[model samples]
Target: MTALLDLVLDAHGGLRRWQDARTVHAEGSIGGHLWSLRGQEGILATTDATVDVQQQRLVFGDFTGPGLRGLFTPDRVAVERPDGEVVAERNAPRAAFAGQGPDTPWDRLHALYFAGYALWNYLTAPYLLTRPGVVVEELEPWREADEDWRRLHVTFPETLATHSTEQVFYYDTAGLLRRHDYAPDVLGGTPAAHFSEHHVRASGLVFPTHRFVVPVQEDGRAASEPVLITIDLTDISVT
Candidate 1:
């Protein structure tokens, strides 16, 4: 790992600790204007999240209401009941966004794909950058929120479906991930600034328990109003 990556990982409980965990669980509420515009408001407002630490997989229980869950992975998206009965399933789900635009409304599966990969990426980072086929490079410092934050530009292999193949991660002097910038491919590559704060540790792993996403201005800073997405986590644990 790079020196910058090591610093950030150590601040977030270390890669050694992360490798010891298999799964992560959390209870959270997620919402914002993005949902409203995508016609999926309240879909993930409140739910139990389970993520695979070793793979790009996540599941939101009660996602479609009680007795059901939304499953997400790079290859598939599905809705199923607790009994393992799948209500619907789509293979190679990312292709579903072929002709999507910023104003386009998303179906439940589309929302499932977006939320699933996003949370997985968020929950397993710094360490995630060390994965095979992932490239990380430290960039010049960025002045933001009154602090000069270090930046990293990461490129993910096509096999890994994330907000975008190329994205930037900003870390504070203390090595916390203060902000992240990416373009949501499903939204026609709209620039976005995602902020991470209210950090908490669970089973020796660190996470930003509260976060919000907004538009990125020409200056590479976030616009203050109109929050696109808000995520607050409670009872986070890794095992």
Candidate 2:
């Protein structure tokens, strides 16, 4: 299992290389018209962040023209603004973030990406056991020509909401997650939904470089709410 885990890590960018460093910085754009974030436009802002795993500290500065400053660790979550006014504060165990839920698409997307990108060590590190009741399955090789990609599927055993029955994750030859598929939590029900994204290796970390959210709509028309959201990362560096 440890060797297999190493394969997975190497497939990403090498665990040894990433774990060797205590802090990493990333600049990226998150949430916009693709996700139909009202009043947000392309490149809503650029962000600079530092994560210190040993100290369990995160501090990020946003240049999106005056907004939130955030710090998150296993024990606490704090937020402030450009004016140095703390806006929110919370102290809770990290486990609280992993409860079963009646989730919306937004919920699943956020939970998956946030957990996957920021805390992959917690999920895949050999020391920590996999979440209970969450069965992990290894899939056969599959190819998508349009995207010029091949994948290994990782299936989740649990459902998302009452209806979210299936979870499928795709990794490239390198083991970085490229897509997520969610299906109805029922027998022979609605089709699966696909969330496809791209990742860039910045600061020895693979973060979402591009993302598109696709809803399985019956009418083939745009969703009442934005069915698709895309984020493009730029100017990433660690200080």
lDDT of 2 by residue, 19-81 (tens): 555665555655534323322333234545655533445565642235666655545555668
lDDT of 1 by residue, 151-215 (tens): 99999899898999999999998899999999988788989999999999889988998999999
The pairs that clash in candidate 1 are none
TM-score of each: 0.98, 0.53
Top-scoring candidate (TM-score): 1
- lDDT of each model, Cα atoms only? 0.91, 0.44
Clashes of each: 0, 6
Stretches > 4 Å off in candidate 2:
2-5, 33-44, 52-58, 63-68, 73-76, 81-85, 90-136, 146-167, 182-200, 203-208, 216-227
At residue 227, give the lDDT of candidate 2. Answer: 46
Q: Specify the highest-lDDT model's number.
A: 1
TM-score, structure 2 vs. true: 0.53
